[model samples]
Target: MHMDIEKLVESGSIVNELDYERAMVADRKLRLLAKTNTHFKHLRNKLRNLIVEYEKRVWSNEDAVDAELLAQSDRAQLIIEKERMFLEKRKKIIQARLKDFSLTQAELGLLLGHKSKTHMSELINGIKPFTLQDLVIISKIFKLDIDSLVPKYLSIEKIDRISAVIEEINNPKLSKIKPTLLSAS
Candidate 1:
């Protein structure tokens, strides 16, 4: 059943009302999940700060810190790098969407309440991480229905769960079990 729904979504089919509803629900779930993962964004910023602090400490007194601390700092830096890469991909998607709407950086900056295009470029280049408020403003400006500006990174298990939910909702047996109306004569 999960596979069927996945196949349907992948095939881009709108066979019936159930299929359409399932697709809509899945998309909504994805958007909600993306929004809920705001913690990751915060965590990335915290990690970046820790990395900088650790680097400064090591530089100030290399002999005081042990190898383990250095190794841990390296790990934190690696995680921050990976998160930046993920954000870069999301930025590209947002840029593509902006292009689709024929929007320029200057225009987007104005819409987002920025002073100039340079600020928008910084956000686009991943120099400045986007806050949730930024995403909301972009969504409003572009008339985006879902959190399409932020990329949804779903795990395999998450995909399976979503597919299962879609299948269960669209199951024919469930659809056939309609409530009967009682008529008073």
Candidate 2:
């Protein structure tokens, strides 16, 4: 990753293929984990229940061993929920920004340094995740503030500012307006 950063700094336009490949693998693993997390949750709940029942019978005087485990499980569940929500929110924001910019999948693919539009489509559809590097490049190409890409980090003021900028960009008449010279009376 350090070498990749150096390459990016030196070339300015080149992306390290290895870094992208690693990100793709990481993305797939995350997606799989998300899909299977419910199973883990179910197991945790079952284990907690069994521990509680055992404690009620043979270990009535014993300390609650499942308390720590249950707390950890709850924390894990919360983290998973937060991550899922973040991903969903990010996907919507990216889709909206893409529409606002009027960029096609192929065009976006080129901008993101992907040779195939399929890869771009996958990224867009949440099949392939967007890495931090991808987000930086996309933000630069789209002239978007990085905060606007993440729903949690975005504020109402920032959204208003982004909207104003988009309006200015889309309205040719606004750009064409010339400043009138005022004569002092």
Candidate 3:
């Protein structure tokens, strides 16, 4: 995704490709991950059951344990770990972009109606998650949707999660409820 964006920026500021089409690769990759992860989980559960039952049957036979099974379990565990690492890397990329356009911590605090830069930095650094209001404010300030601003290689699942969070924040019921609470208090 970064490569595409870099190419676009280098060529000119316009994205000649449609976003949905551009997102297709990410979507496919995410779908593959979903399928593989699901299979890995299912296999892991089966492996655990096998190990437990094997232990019951061959408690004294150390050599009876299947090394191949253990190897497969390790591979599955490694895959899951790699997926998690990839997600973290994607998050970092999004964070860096946020910082690139962000005001200083003090400036962000003022914009977000906070009294402390420490809290604001936490949000920007992903040490603390942003509230919906903060996400909205950041999106507007950057002229970007959280999804679009995020790294292109990021899984569509993560993008959808971010979009869902933003949508929930903008929901009319929550928006209305907040004002009512302020009025009542």
Model 3, range 1-185, lDDT digits (tens) per residue? 22231122234322212322222223333343346456324433443344344345544476765776455444334333433344466456445655886646667667778777645543443323456686567567766566542322333334346556656789766555432321111
Off by over 4 Å in 2: 1-65, 125-127, 150-185
What clash pairs does model 3 have? Answer: none
User: 97 in model 1: Cα distance from truth in Å?
Assistant: 1.2
lDDT of each: 0.50, 0.49, 0.44
lDDT tens digits, residue span 1-185, model 2: 11222222234322222333223333443345445465323433443344444435533555544675455444434433444455567667777777998977778788778877645655664445567788888788777787655424322233346557757688766534321111011
Order by lDDT, highest first? 1, 2, 3
> Which candidate leads the pack in TM-score?
1
- The TM-score-based order of candidates, best leading, equals 1, 2, 3
* Candidate 1, position 48, lDDT: 40
Q: Candidate 1: where is the Cα deviation over 4 Å? A: 1-57, 60-62, 140-185
Q: Give one digit per residue, the lDDT tens place, for model 1 in 1-185.
A: 11222344345444432333333333433343335455324433443444344345454586867786555445434334443456556677778878998988778777777875644654665534466688888777667744455534432334346556656789776444322111000
Every model's TM-score: 0.44, 0.41, 0.31
The window of 10 residues in a row where model 1 has the poorest summed lDDT is 176-185
Predicted structure 1, TM vs. truth: 0.44
